[model samples]
Target: MKNIILATTALVATAGVAAADVSISGYARFGATYSDNADDWNTASRLRLQFDVSTETDGGIVFGARQRFQTEENLSTGGATDPNNSNGARFYMSTNGFTLAMGNILGVIEAAPNLYLPTASSGMGLEGNGFYSLAANTSSNGGRFAWTAYDSAGAGAVEGVEVLYSMNGFGAHIHSTEYSYGVGANYTFSGYTVAVAYEEWDAAAPGGQVDGDSILFASIGGTIGAFDVALAYASTEFSGVEADKWSLKGGYDFGTGLTVYGFVASEDVVDESYGIGASYDLGGGVSLEGGITQTDEALDDTIVSLGAFFSF
Candidate 1:
């Protein structure tokens, strides 16, 4: 991420010193993706720019807002598609260790610590290659599942609110929407961390009618001597049926700007899925990445992708 600092400070009668600034950062990737089903390699690419503006009140409170502009190629279709409703905003205020956020709120389930692998992209390949390691994403492997989360695709966005508090090694969040609610907590000790989250959706919720209902996710991940490792599990329920799944992920940093990571997962009904990947940091906020993934969605179905990722 690159920093573009702006403007300066003001003194108020009520509080200490107040500062204001705006920062810009985002990432981009371009590469090729291949799968057995596609029978051909397809060019894939994405670009994103994010603006973050913030000001501190004289009373020691902080207010911030974030917005993004993004365009991405549709690797599955071998073309680009509209991102629909180019604007979605998240706003919040924080003081001490507590924060109150509204508008495009981050879901507690999605914010839980250790829930994602400690990789450059947090999953396989450049675009995450379906992010099957995410226990909340039960649907990608052919199971019924859904959870509340920030809209990353620029789709209008869920009108929601959330509360977040973090201090020391403990963190917690609560999120609510028109038809869904979620809660999660985490704690870190020594070099290890544990986290858990739960979310439920009413029938009227977007995916509730199909796989919403409720979902519980838990994970434990952190540094392990020479390696970083994590394990995650989730249970989802819909209508009268229930299913569960688990995943184990790990990575090793070689101190030479190169990292290797991978995961294996098992799910009820869906069976098994796995992937392995490596990334080389080239300095100047850029990296080269590649991965190979196997899924149970079909017989011998696999994905191979390579790309260069940039942040600025």
Candidate 2:
């Protein structure tokens, strides 16, 4: 019995050493938000947590998992327990410039390419209304399945996927629904990057009506000195109506933890909106940020927001 226990202890130590290559990292974001239009405002505070774990095998294969959690104040229901929440998990593998992910993951076809750009004031361009905005495309949720591929030379890449669903009548019945495949590609050279993507959705309408939609988008961005700039254009075609939109944004770093940024955007069907924002790093992974936006449609209506963020 003493010899058996000694052998088991040695095996456990060996296993622990073998698993030392695994790594874990994550971040948390919390902030407060207040809008000028209280009726349109939904929440004044929010919190989110994200975690990632990864390991590399001896044969050069890398695998990982990511999980995210989010909670926010429920202003519409006058309290916090109104079920306004979201969570998701994702798994991924990669090797030799090629990568693939599955499960409730963010769409690589549309979301991944833009992530290469640096964030402005801890947020994305257009103040969270980047390519993934519901205003940019009617559907915000991604397809059920997604795939990604990259060139061995690492100069270009592509991604595609599809989604399927069948819903019974609640107010209307959807016999069959599918968000068809999408493809995106990007090329980089000498500090400049260009990307383009397309997606299609097919839906069976109420009372046997058949209709569908398609979206196309392209963007280019680059950096110089303490300044960076980006321009993006997108088009959406649904049944009979079509809309086109574009935005331009740039920022300049003044050094010593201060930066200034500005953005302008317009859609064929909506008034032009423009805004400028600034951020000051308070040191120790904390920063102060604020911005104001104005639209031509409502000359008297302006949106303003300010907040602070600290990362551990």
Candidate 3:
């Protein structure tokens, strides 16, 4: 009975106060991406508009929904075509410190706020270069990526369920599907936080697709005075094989609208990789960003990009 409260009594307490909220926010970016492997530069761009709707009734209960209409070009192939457009949706009900969500649910591992690098694409360059910095989604290291995430590709969203709870300095989340599930929790204090997450899936059999069987992840991060830093590690097992990856990154703000960040990552199956980036604020919902990432594989892969971002 730790989080027990009568809904009827909550309704009686608020008595006739009904309010609703709606907001639209998104960003657009365009620029050029350069890959050493391609030996040329290509146009990179994306436009995303998010709609959020919420309503609160007499009770202390609130219901909400969110959807994003995103049109993004395929930057990896050096082609500027918006073929993987997305219109995913997520609905939720919340009260106290708990929220229950369904439809295009945010996977536990994917929802960790401080897990990814603080950049325009959460990685490097104009389009994230695949968000290769993350630990759970090991595709960057030639491993299978099977974590549940908010489906943002036009291939249609995955129907799933999740629950997120946060109170004080502690938070927890759980996500589930027909074949996969994950749970995670974090605690924060004095500008520092520690988090751990685990997930498992069973999609193996005769002629079946073998995804991630299990994964364990951990991270510690915070802002220390003028510098923000984080270190993360992940171990995964899939198809009877096990591998691990780790990342270390940091950022600094010069108080003059200019911020710089750098990162290094290593995985058991691949060579070491690193990246450096910077962003400058130009005021009025606009900014300039640029970055270069070097990934070590069979041959050295480098991605570089610069662009302007507009938000509304």
Candidate 4:
């Protein structure tokens, strides 16, 4: 009987090893920043770590988990700690070209359109810089639930669902449903890609006000004789809002690891903002980047930042 128990334990250990795969990946960034206005100017830095683990069953179902840690710095105090930091985990499964994810995840459908560009920022300017839509308000949270479906061809379209909840911070209350749901689709062909998404916030406001917002985005990118060029556009609309918001971004890569990028965005209800940046790769997983940002409303608040990133 003891031998039988020992054999069962050995079999279980082997199975676990056979079903599991793990990887380590992260990036570190350090730089200096300057602002023309009163926002302050100083050194800037950030570190992020991500862990991914996965397993596959004999039935062709895949399961995995992803966790990340993010940290930032304070420009005025030169302190390393800030409340904007975040740490979270996500669990997901995939089978038969369908994928499902839950637990502290980004809103898939709502955030998809904004992620169309390859810029370092979250493309916040595209939607009136946090004015027309409440999407930016839910940047972090207690958790989120999501689902996705895709074609096996890899270049086909994808559809997804996202739901979010949090009990603290700006909008927190049992009666106030901080939930969102939407559908999105993306297609790629000949070095060009396009995506469209729409989302509705059940109770995005504080006083039980239900607000709905939608975003439309498209991008085209390709290589042209040792240079890479990309162009992107986004339009945003909100419920009960009279004007719409839009943004345009362009970038050119010199192939020698140097690239230039710029963006201009505006909304009729708010002032306009624009930025220009450049980046150069130093090889061996290191790169240098710098950019300048200005807004019409905050004329004195021009920001210039330079930073380096290392990935492994």
User: How would you encode candidate 4's per-residue C-alpha lDDT over 125-232 as one tens digit per residue?
Assistant: 211122112222221210011112111111111222232222221111111114445545555556555555544555443222245543444444555554444444
| Per-model CA lDDT versus the true structure | 0.75, 0.48, 0.75, 0.48
Candidate 1, position 225, lDDT = 75
Tens-place lDDT per residue, model 2, 7-64, is 4345444432212144333333334443455534322444455666776655555566
Between candidates 3 and 4, the lDDT winner: 3
Counting only residues 3 or more apart in sequence or on different chains, how many pairs clash (N, Cα, C under 3 Å) in candidate 2?
A: 0
Residue lDDT tens for model 3, 184-270: 999999999999988777664221225667778899999988799999998877676677888888899999999898888888877
Worst 10-residue stretch by lDDT in candidate 1? 1-10
TM-score list, all predictions: 0.88, 0.68, 0.88, 0.68
Tell me the spans in candidate 3 whose CA falls farther than 4 Å from its real position: 1-17, 75-84, 139-145, 204-212
lDDT of 1 by residue, 1-312 (tens): 011011112223344547998999989888988877778888888777888998888777887888877777752321213643244788877889988777877788778776677766677887666677777666532322246666655653677888888999899998888878888999999988899898887647654434356778898888877799989998877665676879898999999998999999887857788999999999999999998888756345788888999999
Clashes of each: 0, 0, 0, 0
In model 3, what are the clashing residue pairs, if there are any? none
